[model samples]
Target: MNSRDDFTEATKIKLLALAANLCSRCRVMTVGPTHSGDQRNSIGVAAHICGAASGPGSKRYDPNQTTEQRKHYDNGIWLCYSCSKLIDNEETFHDANRLKTMKANHLAYASTLVGVALMAPFEVKNEIRAGIIEATLALCGSGAGKLDLTAVLEGYEDHLKSIDPNYEVEITTTNRKVRYDITAKEGFVPSISIIPSAETRSLLFEKFENLRLTGEDIVIPSEGIDFVGIDIFQELKKTNPKSVIILKSKKHKIESELFLESDKGIFSLGSFQSLLKGGKRVQDYSGRALNGLFQYNFIVDLENEKGTMEFGSTIASWIGKKLLDIKHLPKLLKAHKFLEQTSSYKFTVECEIGNTTLKIPKGIQNQPENVLYFFRRNIKALYLLNEISKTLPIKVSIISPVTTDNSIEIADFSLLLASKPQPERLEPGTLLFNSRLDELPTPLAIDLWCQRENLYLSVTEQYNRTSDLYGNLISFPRWNFGFENFTPVLYSSIDENDRNYIFVNIYSNENTTVAFGLENGNFELL
Candidate 1:
């Protein structure tokens, strides 16, 4: 069925002119010049305000709308590729009303800009230029203010690493400032630099949060110590009357350093190894004995608004809490540990007779969800077959990629099972045939996506009838496939009346390619 009510070419051009070729949400110029004099580069989409198709995945899809209404210019809005996907992905937040309002507001703003350009006099050119400069500066500063510097740096580092796996990016905090140290492969340097435009600085800043200083005055507490003893504080003060001594303790290792405060910022003096512990015990300080084991808990700097702690002394935990801190670090630490720990569950049949289960040393537990589902469906078939004839011996085998290093992952597993089966040699990328006449045709070939996305992964090029669909013909079950360190690549185009379409090329082990199309966020046979 031709259910899509795509906008006409005229309607798309009208939308472009109406929005001044600017994305309604981002205000980015979507149409620009190309190297070819006769051609222009357009990254704009005449996005449907109410989805062209009626379905749950369709954003703001209206069932009552007629084909004419659905395809009309009034039902469309201009947007950039990223903004279009964002609105569809977050449809609840960007509802029909909200999208309409955004479009209306953008049109109004564009009209005002046009009016100003037309009416502004030459006498006020300087004033207008100054105003624009001031506005630009204000926008940049405000955009940067709303960003988390650390996150920006981390995202930038991730991007750099993705472009070149050999690239190494590290975020370091020292001298009261956070900086990024990116190292490419030996004898090579990356040409790309993270220079953000005025409009994009906000986004880039957010993504590269790991690059910037947190401006957090974090203090790693001395395990059980409370307040700094007045005697020890005075002793350290007497040694360096103009500087504060900071002892950074981590994993029972402490480094004593002197920090001199100045108008510009705090300066770190050379470290003094064993300056406090040299020839002295904890009880020799003429203060309460320190007994607990010390470990690093948080980051701190001498540039803290409050005065730095004295060396050979302890700062109260309360004082540390009052200082600036990055509270999410501990949560991030916990999350890292959570990801490291893996677990899984297995399903088995417990009949009045003996329990039927696989006897592999490595049980089905701890396998991927998709693998588990495949085993469950296989078990169901086996259970039914066993009901018919309990005397028949059933043999099951899981085939996986044969690697010389025995490092095949569980996700690569494929099932092979039969009752009273004849032994046959199974080769990689070869079809297995069913010897029994009663058995249905098994799926000889299968192609799985590492990561599934909307409007992608069409197994076949064309299906003549509804029953001819691969899903209906094949007995094989669907599993969401995944792999470690793999990222799916997507291709998109603004073709056919500026309609945005995302395409996926599905490749099987046989080297056959099948293409799929996405229209209005729904998959379509192409």
Candidate 2:
């Protein structure tokens, strides 16, 4: 019941942290400073669940204050800096209707956070407090937070699906055009348009070039003219000279047509519609008409089967490529790491549609040229995976299926012991070979590099981005480490590739549990 002005800075910070943590746990605020980096000197701002101008008796109003007192976190909802700024600066947020919507959102988030905190044990509650502090500071520009890739991809996919399903999709290449016949299904034939932000026309064209054709065929007409007997004989004379007497009759028509006899056959309007329905036609063209104005014509009726087959093949090839391109999406989860080594680690993993590679500590690797290529490919594949996960009914796993044959052996801890202890009786502190973050002892320092790498791989492969920043310097709490009575929490990885070197308190106690290898330099722990 204390008024906002009566609260101490320390108390305010604690309350803000609690609010942010509650919001984060409820999946309201996914990405922010509090959830991404170390927790210290971080501050979270409070937002009103109801408008600041709401009546004093309202739930959002700070009841402990006088009628003129401004309601803040003491009786309002807490928000990250970005949200606060968005509310204050963006005209949309200030709209009465929007304010009402925001109030509902804030109240829902607050109610959920409170529920989660109440159900959690004291230790977990402390962690939640730390998380909130980190979240708060992150808002105040002191920490970072996790990327809500799951929510992002989900929203994107939902939007894509919500569009009218009957729109016909098409891709045009230098040699051919591929079409999707959506009208045949009795749905609105959507005008062909690609999501420009996600893909480019050139990429789609290139994919079309590699498609494979299947099923029946159709042909294109020449000069927009309907083929007659005379035209057929004239075409025959140039392509097949063996005929002694080329007879022409109005009733006689060529059964097949080829590009070699380009002038003989013409397409009818009905045939044009048929070709489009079959997804074979690209675009309408014209050559000659009654008043010197060329009449629009569709390609149909070939003289040679080979020419018809080639045309169909080209269209089919383009279709195949388009399907593949649509299926794969690139992923871009930010990861960070810090190294003192002149030599770097090059991580490589192949995804469903392409490969993913990264060079940690960029210049630390022997082959720096390959690093960029690796990063680019993986980034692309990750995006594809993220996109595909939205539309397709597929479950992407977090664990990499493509693991080194010696990964199990390499992960074994007994091998690291000088006097091989029994596996069953192995105590904590048993070092697994170059321990990844997961295998460390309970009190060990969490390896940020491993966490980032693993999270990236998991997001790309498993469609799961849930991660634990426990036992790491970044996730360490101020109280547990005997720090300056400040709150602590995990922040986001640095950049997109280096998932290590998280921003942490410079004042926290140094612990060696988490260590990194530096070529020509000693290993150090925070």
Error of 1 at 436 (Å): 99
Q: Candidate 2: which stretches are off by over 4 Å? A: 1-43, 47-75, 91-103, 110-526
Supply candidate 1's per-residue lDDT for 426. 31
lDDT (Cα, 0-100) at 401 in candidate 1: 15
lDDT of 1 by residue, 221-322 (tens): 122122232233232233223332222211222333323222334333223222111111110011111110011112222244221111122222212231
What count of clashes does model 2 give? 63
Residue 110 lDDT (model 2)? 62
Error of 2 at 378 (Å): 57
Tens-place lDDT per residue, model 2, 27-68, is: 243233644467543334555544444444333333444533
